[model samples]
Target: MSVEKPEGPGVIAEKLGAWIADVHASALPDRTVEIARLLLLDVTGLCIAGRGESYVRATLQATDPGGACTALGHAGSFSAFDAALINGTAAHGEDYDDTFEGGPVHSGAVVVPAVLAACEREGLGGEALLRGIAVGAELMCRLSLVAPRAIHSAGFHPTAVIGALAAAGGVAAALRLEARQTTSALGIAGSMAAGIIEYLAEGTSTKRMHAGWAAQSGIRAALMARGGFDGPRTVLEGKHGFFKAFAPSRAPDFSPVLETLGESWIMETIAFKPYACGTMTQPYIDCAIALAERGVQAEQIRDIVCEVGEGTVHRLWEELAVKHRPPTAYAAKFSTPFCMAVGFFDRKAGFGQFTEARIHDPAVLALAGKIRYVIDPDNEYPDNFTGHLRATLNDGTVQEVRQPHMRGGAREPLTGAELAQKFVDNAQHGGWNAALADEARGWCETVFGEPALGTIARFRQ
Candidate 1:
């Protein structure tokens, strides 16, 4: 007689583990492989750009600094775990990494580092590394959908909360673990998953470290599982499992997590940022730039009103006065009013727009002070990040613009040429000489052909 498949919290994890363990590079579509390479290139560029940030420097100081794996943008070598941690932090330090549009999680920041470090330490090949990244990113996006926006509503950073599992999944795939070991790794990682949304309160650096910590923790979990350590099979859907523990109020559906496991690839839906700020704020900045381009000078504006999603208002539009004059450069990046002001005043918002001097610019601050938002109940958030802007000029004229969708998402994905240019620009901003940046670009182009660890090692210098 045929037996029913085992059911429990572990059901999701078990199936996911089996799929991950069995998936080969040959099974992935060409588009998926191409997207994975693009993501790797984008994240590597972001890590290089973040190496000079104060938080990354601080992380370097705190960790033991000698081992075999290369730390991107730094000259030092470190243990696999430490390398993953540092590289993950550097990738996310500026909030510039690729984001999964649905979870709004920076999966690349967590998964890329963990998989890369594991491959380096294990002497794995390039194809395996790419496959691992694809699996990890897909899991991260899927897990985020399990609870929808519940993770954010419950005051948890989705990237950190879901990243641990994603990292573990990626590392397990890279290490070529069996289904049981991979499931165990996912279970162990669930306990390690953590990240509070409290960082939003102070505009602190704690948020940047979440990705790194998750990456390191995943490495630990996978290694422990490989060592024959056992863990709950029903970690994901069990009592006090990830969603229930983190988002107690929201009833999570496992359908999204388990449905179309190998047939559907969620990584393709990931969005690349054209602006280096909060993902939701990107469209608003576009609106502001449009107004500026139409000759609506800052001096001509009386009040700037934004119709925003209630979800965005809490993290980005609240405390109008404080947001108008953010306490720190990093804080300014998350402040919708500040970003709007920068766009109008400078006609652009990028890494250069978030410097201390720019954050404190008198003209920008004055314009930001007049910015305010009203909640739009009909907004498509935690799904579509649409933005609407209305500027009332002193001359009694009004100019309004509404963004139908986020620009870099699946709906309006960036072109290959655009992505290539972004890589070059980010590398230059990170202080790489032209020759070095070009060399890095070449490495990304031929990554599939070279040894994974050796290709990554070129970034060490």
Candidate 2:
């Protein structure tokens, strides 16, 4: 069958492609490069930590392909595509990767794996890899802003939908493809973009795999374009384009995609997670931790009520009964009530807090059952993820706390020491010995200053 053409000419994809092709590491601002390095370090730790998850193990067993690229935690190497798929999955498996403040998409989980895999396969240097990552992240964040909440409203996961194109952009940069080739890659990626939000209903592992799948699709699209395959240049803004097909109810604003491409770096706004749960639930965890620090115990509380934004209700707060007693460990991460309860009882939320045993803890469940949310119409969401909490004591005393903004966002970024500790903690959690953990930490500390990613590719060793 012959494909129909988008009417007239399209400049959105062309502009993006030209920018990605021309940008290099030396041209990037110092802060942007530093953030990219930190993200790389953070995502590498997350991948290692996620390797032992049930879903990741199952995926590794099912697709045991061998090639030239390292798969992060695995002792063996795999094809660039398979490596990207597995590493991306590992990065996002625990929902601990960095999130773009604007799109809320897990940018590192998708872009990092694709860029790293391509760099490894092509023998590219660290500078090329870092530049590719920065470009890819900017594209993903901007694309998400084009339609705002349209993707989620249409029952699609923004990461999976927007990630494919972003991955293509990154991989194309890694390969140093020309503008025409990069544009073709992005156009091909549009056809590959797909991911439904159905995992929310059952709390399955499908959501964990979305980033990896998008990464694999992007590498394939970029490779196809390099091999002379042709695709539409208007895949993002033309008829039957990404937003038009995925979000029919909304009109996409194309300005974000091309406005201030070089002068402004959206990747700088990417936020690392303090908690292992959903992005929106991070601020609430802060509130719960604050309350716990104030000496509020589960036994001393009569009821816990949280005020949430209207936008978060459908995904995190609805189905009150189910949210209180989540069916699985993965499900509990998306359950605001469950996360709140865990935060209060443990005074922290991390990899250990999301285990199956902890999910069914009597004390946590008791507090979770008593938890409920009232929609705050004045709240900000899809812009700033904020949280508010209220606790009514058994003595008729009520205490309230509000997290004005997300902790790890641009307003309050993690310090260098904090980031280092996080990497060490993740390494320990992933079953690495003390020496290995320290070694990994040291490598990440100096990787940005190195000439090539030869050491990073061998991190599993």
Candidate 3:
């Protein structure tokens, strides 16, 4: 007979944990494994490149250096957790990390680090890393969908808050916890959950630190649960639960978590970013660039009007109103006008566009001045991160462009080769040696054959 599944926040967490474990133990298809491998390369590259940032530098200076794992651009050693935190933040430092629409957050940076750290500490292999990623991503997406947009509207950075619980759950699943123990871990994570949207008001290093804090906090929660520490079972749906406290507008449906289980994986829907800006602004950037490519010059253009969904405006353009006219690298990265302007003037927006010199470019600023945004009530912002760009050029010529999605998202994913190249490019930024990079890649490629994950751990060390 088919059994009835449990309900409520705590039970949902428990059931989701079991579901993640089951998916990992079963054979994952070749496509999923390959995707995981590509992302591993990409994230590792980012970790290396971002090591010089203030947060990562602080971590390097504060921690006892060990050769556990390679920090992106520097030669240093740190505890596994500290390394993961630094690496995770570094990967996402440029806002070029992967994202998902259903639950608007960067899943890989927060989840991948937790898995990698656990794999190194527990002597696990690639297959185990893949499983941990699956567990963490699945739980994160499911929970993010639970409250839908409520948690975010409440000023919580899902990547850091819900992502923490998911990261912890992924680590716990990798370690093979029972239902009650896993639920206890969720309870533990629930208490640790914290992140805010204050970073947008003034672009600061805290945003980059959120992913690391989440990954580290989750690891701590899992370890505590492993030692039999008990926590609140109804953390998500309790009287003063996460949803109730954080998102009171509309309650999230928990059925999505159990309904699919292993069948409909959220990992498949992940979106890797091409431009290093807010995910909401990507579509707008893409559209703006298209207009510029079609012989549209900034000086010749009369006015550039953009229509975007409310969610996009709220999350990006409106939320960062003061930064619309950016004076710093972080501001430019988060600003709609700045991203759109750079894409139009430069034909492309990448790491280079957000540089100290580019932020003050006269051409970019002039283009940004002509650009104005209006809410597209009909357009899909959060759900459909597509936008409509209308450019009125000299001689009264109007050019319009629209993009439903950018490359690297599940709908338009990057090829394995492209992901590999991106990793190499980012890795080089951190000054990683080619020989070491090749070794790391080779280790990941041959991980499954090894009898124990001990060898893999040595590679990082």
Candidate 2: regions farther than 4 A off: 1-10, 448-451
Q: State the lDDT of candidate 2 residue by residue for 74-171, as single tens digits.
A: 88788888888898998998898899776779998999999988888888887788888888888898998998777888899999989999999999
What's every prediction's RMSD, in angstroms? 2.8, 1.8, 3.7
Per-residue CA lDDT of model 1 for 1-461, tens digit only, reads 95544565557889989999998887898878887898888988888788788898899988897877978889978999889989899888887788876678988889989988888888887877888889999899989888877888889999998999999999998898999999999999999999997877779988899999999988889999999996677787877788888878789888888889899897888998888888889889889888888877888899988988887777898777789899999999889999999988777777899999998899999999989999989888878888788899998989998888888888899898889888888888889888988888877767766655566777887
- Report the CA-based lDDT of candidate 1 relative to the real structure: 0.86
Look at candidate 3 and tell me the lDDT of residue 106: 83
Ten-residue region with minimum lDDT total, candidate 2: 2-11
Off by over 4 Å in 1: 1-10
- Candidate 3: residue 416 Cα off by (Å): 2.2
User: lDDT for every model?
Assistant: 0.86, 0.86, 0.74
TM for every model, in the order presented, reads 0.96, 0.96, 0.92
What value of lDDT does candidate 3 attain over all alpha carbons? 0.74
